[model samples]
Target: MDRITALRARRAGIIEQMEAIVASVGENEDLTAEQQSQFDALRAEDDRVAAQLSQAEDLERRRAAAARPAAPLPGVTAPVAGQPAVPAQPAEKGLTFARMCRTIAAAGGIPHVAAQIAEANGDGGLFANQNMGSGPAGGFLVPEDVSTEVIELLRPASVVTAMGPRMVPMPNGNLTTNRRATGANFSYTGEQTDIDATGYTYGQVKLSAKKLAGIVPISNDLLRASSTAVDRMVRDDVLADAAQIQDRFFLRGSGTDFAPKGLRWQALGTPFATTHIMTMTATPDLQKVTNDLGRMELALGNANLPYTGAHWTMSPRTAMYLTNLRDGNGNLAFPEMQDGQLRRKPVHVTTEIPDNLGGGTESEIMLVLPQHVLVGEHMGIEIAMSTEAAYKDSSGTMQAAFSRDETLLRMIMQHDIGLRHLAAVSVLTGVTWGAA
Candidate 1:
């Protein structure tokens, strides 16, 4: 029926043959070297086939057990807040990548010790290439642990702010003086009479005016630096989260191990890192995922940290993956569309992987109760900022007045979307810069 079944059948035949060989060896005292070699080869083949069959059978059993319907524990109601609920379907095999590098000039070395007993060894454990994860002294590989690290927030860097414009009074208006050549060499009769020193005073007093200038608001470099730093710090925190998750899998373990890739260190210390760029194709509803992320984003906005700017538009595909979610009705609820579309309700959510590098890292954090799963639980999530906008209030109009014409102009300050590990920590990147 299967390779395993076939192998078992072949092994049974081999055993019979091996028995005959044993009988012959006893009766004849000695057999030809060629026959003895053949017997030994056959015995070895039989053992190999038997092992394969046993392994196949074990796999089948585990699969069957996993397929069995899960029964809820007696009296276990709602899952505690902040924890992802266990998936009713076998935990979807998932992978996360993490990368950790030193932002400082030097990083300490990671300590080594005997590998953990649970670590994958020379033979492939839960994943392939177990050797790749091994470190010197058979210890697990990990980011160099450091006692002191920089917290970009505390640094002088911050968002730029305009305390309106400073006023330098200018001479109100332009002045022009006309000095008529009253007494020219060829003047009119009356003028000629005035030409004589006794007739009119030849000397003239001329008046000219010089105007004082105005002072304009200067660009705040320090504020820009601070905003940049805030963005970098948030992103670094996210990267750190991914790094922590990766560290947990330093030793051999199931699922894919994520490593940071395409890390771009831009000016102002902004670090753009993405999870291992692997794509998974599934029926994961994108719309539901979008709504969930939007709610969180709105919460961040309401909390006052809207750093990301217009550049933070999320992809429609990513939105579809995020917005449609299970609702209070315990039914698939699309944020935009209240009613369920397809018969398949949103059972679980795989947060949209954030794109467009920003200050914060996407996390598998957040607990959401799904309608389909018997145990309402939180699921790991990916997040990205869709868009960020900002406004300042100077002239009650939320606009700044420039000195150029002493006119009030509305200025929309742009910022980048920033993700925070928690709502309390989200400081919208670059939204409000220079201190007023």
Candidate 2:
């Protein structure tokens, strides 16, 4: 039996012995002083045992009371291992920010931030700051091309617009030809060429639009995904560009003059290389994009995701992504964010599209611009620094860290594509001046 049950049995036996002693004492008429003293000692011992039993009984009662079932929490489900999981209610939607992060991580993307916000504003519509990161902002939504079928899904393909190292071949006529009968003259030639695929690629997908200013601050966790995506695009795209192709030969860093986009550095006070300027031609393949998104969803769906805006949009270049900041060592860091969150943060990273930079139907601007504008030129870089943690410390000092980790770079693609495509593209590639 359990300890409680044993204690009860012992107490019952003690009570019976006490009662027998009391009865014997009452029946005896003339007891000697010695007998009386012995009886009194036995009575004292019995009283002590009774007090111990009372305390034990009280403890047992309390434990039994505590073991009773409790009414379940309204929306919450019964806890497993004494901790409740996501709620069971439909409105509660069972989706958790942590789970979303896991899903994004599974997708080979980073899920930096995840949290739920107020569902509505003072006006009663769902509040815009309801999600905090790039993964599961609200509930999980199926990506456009994801399928229950196996073998059909794949990760997004990496494209390298540049090339790797190589050597030029001599003319075929110079090698092993009939010099007498065919009357061919032969000569040998060897030429060395450098293949430099040092530049990165940036792409955009559109999303729904909503004003988020003064509604919520973009958390540090959410920014991690973007930082990671930029890094992956840099590394993979760089390697891909380095690989030589039959039609397009690879270029080298030494060949900066011929380098695509002149080693596009995100933000530098001056140009790094004049030869790196290269143009991009979009090869639109709908099937490829669908497969990429499907893979992204599959990878992220299994992770704990941070809160983020459900809609997402991507662009090759924007102002928030163009600024270059340095440490004491002068290393590069690029500041960037989606337009909606940028507006909410108001950190001087982005500008109004049509403000001082006049002449645009679009409504966005790059908060950071070159001190001197170069007509028909866009600066480029394979990878740029991203903010690790930007916040005021205990001393009220604003502190931040650069995201130099490549693993983190590959993790940022877990943003919600469904939400991102709804908004119009509003990045300012050029500045406008007021009417002269």
Using TM-score, give the best candidate's number: 1
lDDT of 1 by residue, 308-347 (tens): 2211212233334334446567665545433312222221
Count the clashes in each prediction: 54, 69
**Best candidate, lDDT-wise?**
1
Provide the overall lDDT of each model, using Cα atoms, as 2-decimal numbers. 0.29, 0.28
* TM-score (C-alpha) between model 1 and the true structure: 0.16
Scored against the true structure, residue 261 in model 1 reaches a CA lDDT of 14
RMSD of each: 32.3, 26.8
C-alpha positional error of residue 278 in candidate 1 after TM-score superposition, expressed in Å: 48
TM-scores for every predicted model: 0.16, 0.16
Error of 2 at 255 (Å): 23
